[model samples]
Target: MGVDNNSISVSLEKLERFIAAALRRAGLPEADAATVAGLMAQADLQGSDGHGIIRLPQYIRRIRSGGINVRPDIRVVADMPGMAIVDGDNGMGHLVVSRATELAIDKARTQGAAWVGTRRSNHAGPASLYSAMPLRHDMVGIYFAVGNANHLPPWGGTDMLLSTNPISVGVPAGDEPPVVLDMATTVAAYGKVKAKAKRGEMMPEGWMIDREGRPLLDPTRSDEGFLMPIGGHKGYGLALIVGLLAGTLNGAAMGRDVVDFNKDHVTPTNTGQAMLVLNLAAFGPVGGFKEAVDRLVGDLRGSARMPGTDRIWIPGEQSHARRQRYRETGIPVSRGVAAELDQLARELEIPPLA
Candidate 1:
C-alpha cells in the first residue's frame, strides 16, 4: 500500500486487517479484535472520520494499560420482555453495543419494541453505527451515549459538567436511502476538535469559549476553554437529559466522573450507552410504512430551493453519498493520522496501514 497524490487511500479489507492485528497485539482475542475492526472500518466507510481508525491508537493504548477488558463477559444484569440492562464488563464499546443492539432487535421482533442499556463500555464509534443497525431488520433504531469525556457545562455556568452526549436515530425507507440523524449536543464533537488540533487547523469561533466566555478559535487552546452547546441553554438541557438517560439510568460514569480517555489510558471509562428499537410491523405493514417514509423524504427533498442553493438533502443523504464515493475510491486517511498509525504498527510489530 502506498500514498497516491499525497493522500493515503485504504481498502476496507486492509484497514480491518491492520486494526485487528493492532488489537490482537494489544491483547484482544482474535475474534473480538476482528469484530471491532469490522465495525470501525464500517464507521470509516460511512464517513465517520473522527470515530473510525482515528481512535485505534488510543484504544490500543488503553488496552495495553489495562483500562479495557479484552475478554469481556457482557451479560444482561436485568431482563424484561421489552427491556434489558447489560453489563459490558469494561469491554470495548463496539462489542458491547453490538451485542446490546442485537439483543434489542431480537426483543423488538418479539415484543414490538425494545430498549437496552449498557455500562462499563469504552468509547464506541459514531452513534450512527448502532442507530443504523436496525435498518436491516426494517425497524427504526435510536441510540444515545454519554461521551467518554466532559467538554461542556450547564448554561450560564463554567463547571464543565456535561459531555457531548450524542444521539442518533435511523429510520428505514422504501425507495430512498434510510434517514439517519447523528449529532453531538455541542457545537462540535470533541473528537472533531482533537482532529483539527492534530491537523494543525484552527477551530471556528462558535466551537468553544474561554473561561471568560470569549470565543476560542485555536485548537491547541482547547483545554483552556470548553465546547459550546449547540443552542446555548437548549442544547445544554438536551445534553443533560441524554447524560441522565444514558449514564445515570445505566449506573455508569457521568458528569465529573467521566475520565478523559484521550488524556488517561489507565482508567476504565465505564461509559454508558443506550439503544432502542421499534418494529415497523408493530404499527402497520412494513412495506406501507416504508413507502410512506419514502414519500415524506421525497416531498422534503423536492421542495423549492433558495437562491444559490443546489438541492435539498435529507438527514442521511450526504452520508449515503459519501459512503458510495468512498467505497469506489477508497477511504482517505490524513497524513497525521497515517503517521500515528504507522508508529503504532511499528510498536506492535504489525504491518503499517500505508
Candidate 2:
C-alpha cells in the first residue's frame, strides 16, 4: 500500500531515482552519486531500512553544508604488496570505500592476500557491500567501520565515548548461497531505535537504558539513555579493538576526535575503515574451501532450536530473503523519515520520493 505525504511507502525504483536526482542536484558528480545511490538502494533491497534511503536527507545536508567533497579523487596514501592505506579525499563514503575494496581485491588476486584501510571516509551505508565484493572472485572479504558517532561507552563507565562499531564477513560457496555475517557491536543498531522513535513506537527493553541502568523503551526518551552493547563487556571490547584497527592505525579520528556527523556536518569527519581480502588459493584448493564453508554453514543452520525459534537460521539468510521480498514489493519507510527526505528535496529543488 502506498503511503501519503504523512508517511513513506516507496517502490524501490522510486527511491533510487529520487536519491540519484537529489544527489546530482546537490552537486555531486553524476557517476559518483549514481554509485552511491545504487549502493544505498541495495541497502534497502537487503532490508537495511535504517541504512538505506533513510540516509538521503542526512547526506544531502552534509553535501550542502560543505562536509562532503563532491569531486574527490580517491588515491592510495601508503602501499605495499599486501597492505595499503587509502585516502578518501572527503568523498561520499560509499564511493570511496567501494573503490578501496576493489583495490584490495586486485592486490589480493596478485599477492595472495591484501589489507586496505581508509581515512577521511564518511559513514558508508553498510559494511556487507564491500565485504561481499571479493566473494565474486572466490575470495573472502572482511570489513570494519568506525561509527560516525559515539553512542556506546566503555565497560563500567557512564560516559558515552565509543561507537557501536560494525564488522562484516563474506565467504563464497559453489551452489549454496554465500555465508555472510554482518553485525554491529551494539545490542541494536542506533538506526533501528531511531526509526522506532520516529514511528512513535516502543523499543524492546534490552536495546537501550538510562544512566541509572533502567530499561528505556520509550524512543522519545532515548536521548537520556544510551545503547547497550551486545554481550556486555565483550561487545564493548570488540568495538574498541575495531576502533584501534580501523581508526588509529590509519591516522584517522579516534575517541574524542570523531565528528558526530549527525549533529555537525561542517567538520572533517576523518572516519577510518578497513577491509581485508583473502584469496582462497592462498590457504588451499578453492573447491575444498567452498565445500568446507558450505558444510559449516549447513551444520549451523541444522542445529536444534528452542521452542520459539521454529528452526535455526544462519546470519545472512533473513536479510537475503527480505531483500528478495522487498525487491518484488516495496520498501516501507516510517512517516518521519519520509518527511525528512521531502524537506531535503524541497531545499534542493529536486524531485522527491512519493
Candidate 3:
C-alpha cells in the first residue's frame, strides 16, 4: 500500500483479502465472503468508491445484528424456459445477483434471451458489476434494482415513496471497450450522498432539495431532503417502472415497505434485482455485429466537439480507463474511508488494510 496526503493506494489483491477477512469474521462462509469481497473490490477498481469497501462496515454491522442471512439457501423459486425468479433468503445481494447473472447467461445460451429476478436480497455493489458480467460470453446484459431505501417521492409530492431504482446496460464491441451504462434514475445515487458525508464534503445544488423545495447542498443533512430525479417527472416515472419490475413483479419490498437500511440494521431489507441477457449469436453473425459496433464507436469518438468540449465519450469509457489505470497504480481510497476501515478492523479483530 502507498499513502499520500489525502488518500491511500492499495493493491486490488490486498483490498479484496481485507474485505473477505472482515466478512468471514462477521460469520459469512469463506467462499461466500471471498465472492462478495471480489465484487466489492471490483467496484472500486471501476471507480465506484461509494459501493466498494467503503460499505464493508455497514455490511458487517447488518450481519452481526442478524439482519442478513450469512448462510442463506438462495434458490430458484419460479422457473420457465426463458425466465426465472430467485429467492435470496435474505442473503447478501452480491451473491444473489451473481447467481442470477450466471443463470441468465446459461439460459441465454440456449434460449437466445433470458430474464432472471431475485427477491429478499440485500444491498449489492455497483450496478455495473453485474451488468458487465455477460460481456465475457458475447452477450448484452441489462439490469434493474429496487434501492434499499426510499429517498424520493412522487413528482409533486413530499412523501418519499420511491427509491433511486438504478438501471444498467452492457453491450460488447470488437476493438473498443464494452459499452456499459449504469446509473440511478435520480440525479445522483444515495450512495454518493453518503460518500460525500463520509468525506465531509457538500453536495452540488441540483442533486437534492429540502422539504421547502430549496437546494440541499449539505450531505450531512441528507435526511432532511429528497433526491431529484434525472428529468423531473420523467425520471420519477422511470423509477416507478423499475421498482415495479424489480420489486413488485418479484414479490419483494418496494414503495412504503422498503426499509431504510442505513438507519435500521436489524431488519431484512428484502431488496430486489433483475438481470436480462441477450446472446449476440442469436441476433446475427457475431463478428459482423462487433465490427459494426466498433465502427459506430469510432464514428462517435471522431465526431466534432464544441469549443470547450475535449472529446466525445462512450458509455463506460471512463470506467474502462479507470480499471486499466487502477490495475497498474492500485485503487485509491480516501483518508476518511481508510480510517473507517481501520476502525472496523479493530472491531473485527482482523488485520488492518495495508
Task: Estimate the TM-score of every prediction.
Answer: 0.98, 0.95, 0.99
Model 3 accuracy (lDDT, Cα): 0.95
lDDT over C-alpha atoms for residue 211 of model 3: 97
TM-score of 1: 0.98
Residue lDDT tens for model 2, 1-354: 566554556777887888899999989888887888889988888878778888888888899899999999899999999999999999899987898899999999989999999999899987888888899999999999899988898998888788878899998987678888998899988878767877778999899989999999998787788889999999999999999999999998888888888789898798899999999998889999888878987888888778888877777778878787877767777778777887887888887675
Candidates 1 and 2 compared: the better one by TM-score is 1
Residue-wise lDDT of candidate 3 within 1-354, one digit each (tens)?
678887899999999999999999999999999999999999999999989998998998899999999999999999998999999999999999999999999999999999999999989988999999999999999999999999999999999999999999999999999999999999999999988988888999999999999999999999899999999999999999999999999999999999999989999999999999999999999999999999999999999999999989999999999999999999999899999999999999999995
**Which structure is stronger by lDDT: 1 or 3?**
3
Which prediction has the highest lDDT against the true structure?
Answer: 3
Which sections of candidate 2 miss by over 4 Å? Answer: 1-8
By lDDT, rank the candidates, best first.
Answer: 3, 1, 2
Ranking by TM-score: 3, 1, 2
How many residue pairs clash per model?
0, 0, 0
